[model samples]
Target chain A: MHEMGIALEIHRVCREAVAGRGPGRIEKVRVAVGELSAIEPDLLRFAWEAVTRETTDEGAALEIEWHRTEQVCPSCGPVPDRAPGTWLRLCPSCGGPLELRGGTELEVLDLVFAAEDDPPGPGGDEPGEESA
Target chain B: MSSDERDGRRVTRDFVRIRKSALAANDRVAGELRDRFRDAGTLVLNLVSAPGSGKTTLLEQTVRRLRDELSLGVLEGDVATELDAERIRALGVPARQIVTGGACHLESRIVRRALEEAEFPPLDILFIENVGNLVCPTSYDLGEDFKVALVSVPEGDDKPFKYPGIFRRALIAVVTKVDLLPHFSFDLDRVRERVATLNPAARFVAVSSTTGEGVDAWCDLLREALAAKREGRPWP
Candidate 1:
């Protein structure tokens, strides 16, 4: 759905970030996708491939790190029975209201780029030899 | 150069840590719009729901009852056509239609342009009727003081469980078409219970546009929200 829009935004941000650093090809892009972000990581990756097909960062790998939201109860502290995907309105042990924490995040964590200046080493160079 | 020379060179790889939100630009614009609403003392509300959920119908009724008490404006969002905006304008209220073309959600940039194009006068309330969608719209912020999710009786009570994203983020859940409760097998209590599980802090109001059954209560809640915004108090 809107994964295309998200992929475009990611490309724009990554391009800007890479532009400021120097000339390099992006090797990997790490992103944090929260459970509540409403973004499907698989679809986003597909969209990324489509968007970057002809760009300078073509073939760059997109790594998604999933994040989960936690429910914290006032009286019972963190609820233990509530599963990761399931939701609970009240604490099972104390019947207190539960508050949600974390999740709702969609951010670019880091970018790995291969510098252009580093070429193949000279032939017959010893392991301890220094090159200019 | 020999094969060893090619292998001896070290490839430089740089790892840059950013940790920035993907929607940062959109969020920034939304924050600015929030400041503008606060400065003008206008209570902004974003209404979201599926197509044919009677959102425009409920809005029409809401404007009719509250027009004398407060000045109101509306921004209608649709994939195409200005039919909804025309309907609101027929009520003599300032209304602007934002044709999103193919976008499923209303972003802050387009909303800013639409607000400017509408040339809205000083008003007590401004309602942004988001594109009839429940999923994509939940992720975008339109600088609204609160978000209201509306579902009709025929849409079934399991909507809260099936599409928890909107219910979790919305400040209020409105059950529309309650006049047809006898015809439909809608469980009011079950819907309320499920929505409560998703969002414990959300408020629910059941209304029927045809019979005006719960419109007064909905209006009262809106009035309270307006008062809270004007007084800079935390919303109830």
Candidate 2:
């Protein structure tokens, strides 16, 4: 599936970010997948695991935030009653053309990585210096 | 401290926000291709449709009709095969076949490579017949002036609703193989209505490549699109 290609892209993005931070291992990757996009979250996660296996980012969590397309009617503004995965061509109330808004997103949102000093282990009781 | 003790120390987890599109590389290449096409004054059309939708047949008819009036080039994409490219070349036009191996869709980078390899000449219009798929190809932009989606009568009238993502982004919707309409229970009006709902701005046309029915009208539409591009205007 094309999900493999998407996963590779995500891995590349994460690898670049990780490289910039010096020695580190990726902890998690968050991505936004839109309803209109062709990617399936489960398949993407599977592909990510396959791509990251035996790599520096092995065991990294893949988080997907689902983005739903907003359906709006020319006459009624936003249609709240429209069901998910279903399209309404016309407004149910006033019989006007319905429009879709903002559902093409496919981007890597953020990445969490453990620096070299911070090994994978339990947290210390004392809070360390916080960096944003 | 030993290595185990060091592992227990508070490790910092960095959060880096990198909001970038997965297809950013492809998009960048597509933008460059768009500039090149504009400079060449070429009106490029990216044709997408399901397999067996008669995209090649329609293109053959188009090449036959417009070869004398305008210069044309075709970049045919397939997973593995040069048959379609050969068909276009048989018409005496410059055609290149991009064998994508196992890739489902064609990216702008490969398209740029194919154009370079083919030594494509400056033309009035260029047609890119995408890999015959409705899903994967919709996401990749090939730097075309506009996209045209084709659906034959046998593909059923519900294709627009079933694959709204592609239909919604297409500038033109062509219903191919109209000659088979009498043999099959295909409702052209219903398909038009569905496609209209998906993409209100798309121009709809029905043609039979075999019988040459509505072929002139399709050619006229392409000519108009080419003229609009030359004048720096939008197509109807």
Candidate topping TM-score:
2
The CAPRI classification for model 2 reads as acceptable
Cα-based lDDT for every prediction:
0.87, 0.87
Q: What are the candidates' interface root-mean-square deviations?
A: 6.1, 5.2
Model 1 lDDT tens row, A1-132: 788888888877777777865666788999998877878889999999999998878999999999887789877687775565678767888888778776788998899876554454566333333322
Off by over 4 Å in 1: A81-85, A118-132, B1-10
lDDT of 1 by residue, B1-236 (tens): 01122244544567777888888788899999999999999999999999999999999999999998899999999999999999999998999999999899999999999999889999899999999998888888999998999999999998887777788888889999999999989999999988887788888999999999999999999999999988889877
Clashes of each: 4, 1
Model 1 chain B, TM?
0.95
lDDT of 2 by residue, B51-132 (tens): 9999999999999999999999999999999999999999999999999998888899999999999998789999999998
RMSD of each: 3.8, 3.6
Stretches of candidate 2 off by over 4 Å are A118-127, A130-132, B1-10
Residue pairs in clash, model 2: A118-B11
Error of 2 at B219 (Å): 1.7
Candidate 2 chain B: 10-residue stretch with minimal lDDT: B1-10
Fnat for model 2?
0.53
- The window of 10 residues in a row where model 1 chain A has the poorest summed lDDT is A123-132
